[model samples]
Target: MARWPLVPATDAPKNRDPEPPEGEAFPVTSTGLASEQPLRSAAFRWFLAGQSISLAGSAMSPVALAFGVLEVTDSAAWLSAVTTAALVPMVATLLLGGGISDRYRRDIVLRLTSLGAGLTQVGVAILLLTHQHPALLLPLSALNGIFQGLTTPALRGIVSNLAAGRGLQQASSLVASARNATRILGPTTAGLLTASVGGGWAIAADAASFLLAAAFFARMSLPNLPPRTENGPTMLGELREGWSYFSSKPWIWTVTFAFGVFNALNMGVWQILGPVIANETIGAEGWGLVLSARGVGSLLASVVMVKLTVRRPMVPALSSMTLGAVPLILLGVGATTLWLAAAAFVAGVVSEFFTVVWETVWYTHVPERMLSRVGAHDEFWSFVPIPIGQLSTPVLAAAFGTAAVAVTGGGVAAVAMLMPLLVPSLRRIEIKRGGD
Candidate 1:
């Protein structure tokens, strides 16, 4: 968020303001101030309020959607199809979305996408309420994905802008905490709504949240960006530029690649086999409790991170990620529910810790102008392996048995997380203090 100028002030365009106006939401600065608090900024407070509400709604919609699908046709295959419809478009459009964010006002991009997403959700609610054909969900889900892709990159950039230089870590931590807390509340809310009013009402609530968040975004006052010159790079050229910058940074690309491997293996085992193992040992209710424990742990970590600062973050960040493999290992070994919950809790804490630190590092080091495009690349690569894991895990578990697959996947994920440490550049990265 440090608008640490990429070029000197003397070389900046005359139209550009070196600092934010007196009443702007994010006051620009060259370096972070440790005493600054994110919540004190009216802009950040509004942003957080909107994001927290939207995240809660987002978390609820999935549960409602799943139940709605099952009610219509108790076919797991149809559910998978609906999920895939959303995933494919989201992954496919990420880079293009990132490029668009870089060329425009990130807040405006976010506002438009949120509006689109809300409208799509409204359509989904209508379809569910009408008991329409399940096939209709495919198009609706695909539209949701397109909106999601367009929104994500801009989200990262906007958070940085909201807090700017001084309160980035606190901002990231607060946002993450809201997300973690919502993960616990959202599903429970969805269950209640699905039982009483039906899935359509729950989804309708999600649509309202999106619309409200869009309104908050519209009200934010951000510094004006320089107008895009007619001779500026084309979208394709801009994408190439983003890729060039992303690939050129060893710390950036290597950590992202490592996360790709880690996410693929970890998601495969934890998402697919964890439930299977839980069903065999613990009941469905117990499995839910285990997940709830993890969410609680993540929330605690985010609170801790508000005051915690790491000078050299990557070392600890990567180191703690190894904890992510613990729950898988416990599940593979047929641990009791209590044991599994304990492992999951610890894993969640470390995982959230890594997330907070990672965002802080990016906000501190990356140039604000290119943050969205670069983040898009980072998100794109990290997400690309998810489907591979989701698809292959069940097949592997069937062939090798769930226990063996879970254990092997856990081992592989741990190694994948640690492998980035081997890169000297990654290991040596430190927070850029005082605009270094």
Candidate 2:
């Protein structure tokens, strides 16, 4: 890792290269495309190992929780509430927790949150296992949601400090790939575990992932990132400043707005309806195959974008996000057939490509010191729409029908996402594009 200077360095995000005129020659790869960061180093190698374990555990919780809720009560309305109960607190606490990540040693914050998440999982598992007050799982799940909400901004910010400067992009790619890879196992395993053992086993497994995450985070030699500015004296004051920073950048706000609308409609589809569709339509094994197919797609993206030459970072990033809408549209429309779902799964891989590139763009363009706060702002804007989707999907499902609602949501996400794309200032944004 590059030695951290007392004063912060001014490296822009990976994809924010200056753009040339339409007919001009774009800069090709010079230094390299693949990440130059040393992953073989003991510290980062351990960090990678730990993240892998934690993600494996993290994958099991949602499937087990959702299915358990379904087994107890078939009401879609109740399920919506459960989803809301878990998501609201998680998104609500994001900015505050992001502040904490930026101000403190990030690894410590990760460890502490992981410990809490672990405990939440274990406690919920015990409650479910004892067959005592199964209803209590909602509150327990809410607690876990809170930890996850708080962890994301912190984790996203901390990751850059894990590897070398060049490795930053690689780290982002790995994160996306890891998530896709883990999703393939986590839910599949959860389904089997629930089918064979019960929800308790899945939740228990999730708890262990947190404990393992905490242990692994504890050993990191991450550099401390001093905050760029004071968080502020009051809640409103901090919020105003955060908004100021968020609004100052056209690229950031555009991406935030685009995702906000897209995800608001898309999240419920992916989490609730997507799972139900898996159980009823595709079947567990088929769903696993679909998810794995998507994982392979994302893995392909990592291999290609991470190695093959990329030009105009923001354009490709924007293009991927825009293209992402097509796959999502296909996902709901194509749900019935395993072959179609497999195609949709490939669409998901394209979605993930946008996800990783943009994440790297944000982490790189935004000042490192304010990375977490900016991240909180980014997350907050984009995620605000998600809970709305959660609360609304049941009603939409009941009124319009589940398939119709999924189709509508998918359509809405795509349409709403384009509002930002139409803005030339946003679409033309050329931050740090090109390779390492």
Number of the top-ranking candidate, with lDDT as the measure: 1
* Candidate 2 accuracy as lDDT: 0.68
Per-candidate TM-scores read: 0.91, 0.79
- Please estimate how well model 1 matches the true structure, expressed as its whole-model Cα lDDT: 0.82
Report how far residue 281 has shifted in candidate 2, in Å. 7.9
Q: Distance from true position, residue 403, model 1, in Å?
A: 0.8
- Cα lDDT tens digits, model 1, 1-436, are 3222243678854423343221122233322312346787777787788888889989998899899888787889998998889989999989999888878877789789989999999998999899888899999999999999998898877776777554788889999999999999999999999999998889999999999989987776566677778777788987887887788767789889998988898888888888888888998989998999999999999999987877788888888888889888888999888998998999999999999988887776666667788999999999999889988999988899999988888888888888888877666556533343
Worst 10 residues of 1 by lDDT: 21-30
What clash pairs does model 1 have? none
Clashing residue pairs, candidate 2? 13-364, 13-365, 15-432, 15-433, 16-431, 16-432, 16-433, 17-431, 17-432, 17-433
